[model samples]
Target: MLGIGIVLSIFGLGFFCWLLFTLAVYALPFLAGLTAGLAALQSGAGVIGGLVVGFFAGGATLALGQMAFATTRKPVIRIIIGLLYAVPATVAGYQVSFALAGIGMSSGGWQTAFAVIGAVLSGCTAFSRMTLLVPPPDGQGTGGAYSLADERLHDQRH
Candidate 1:
């Protein structure tokens, strides 16, 4: 029974991590909404009102970020936005790493190293997910398309 419980717990943790990875793009917005809602509730706003305000605020922020990312053609601006989007993931990564390290590992260089590794992985994952590469319209070659011919040409160019 103990073995079975441990196996189940591991599976549950894996699933939770997978879900977190898949929904990383929404983490920031959800956190913003949650914070706003809690503050409003504490400030004497009714539960419903607080929830409504939080939902709209969060959705608007997420939409604005998405629009900026979609409309911008400047690489520098896009990179900046992408980095902002990854902030939540990086924070979560650091926390998770710290927790894992605290469980059985030492509390010095090893913990810091784990945290940095986690932050990098999570930040990259978030950035990639948030800044999706949309294919150019009408099959026009934009050097972003992945195909055998494109690969061959790219290899030849190098």
Candidate 2:
């Protein structure tokens, strides 16, 4: 039983880490949702009402960010949008890493160092994920049949 418990603990930790990484990109939306939820709860909304409000708030935050990222053409504007997503992820990563590290490490210095590293990696991951919605560089074939037709013509020409 003891051995089984150890195995299960390790498995749980691994799963937790994976979940952290997978949801890193949603940090901003999560932040928004959490804030809205708390506000609603404090403002006399019932539990179910707060939850519904929070869900919509988070969804709108993500949708707006993606749309802004996809529609903006300027590199500077895109970088700003990317930073908005990354900054929150980095903060969350640091807090999580510190908490996780406290489970195994004792030294304060080491824990902070580890947390900072995790924060940087999380920020980079968030930025990369947001970049997926970037607009085409040349503004051509951004959507519709044009981009498809352009690709076919390029293939035939070469």
Residue 62's lDDT in candidate 2: 96
Error of 2 at 88 (Å): 0.7
Best-performing candidate as measured by TM-score: 2
Residue pairs in candidate 2 whose N, alpha carbon or C atoms collide under 3 angstroms: none
Poorest stretch of ten by lDDT in candidate 1: 134-143
lDDT of 2 by residue, 11-130 (tens): 987886677777888999988998998899999998998999899999999999999998987889989999999999999888888888788789999999989988888888888999
Alpha-carbon local distance difference test for all models: 0.77, 0.88
List where candidate 1 sits over 4 angstroms from the true fold: 104-108, 133-158
lDDT of 2: 0.88
TM-scores for every predicted model: 0.74, 0.80
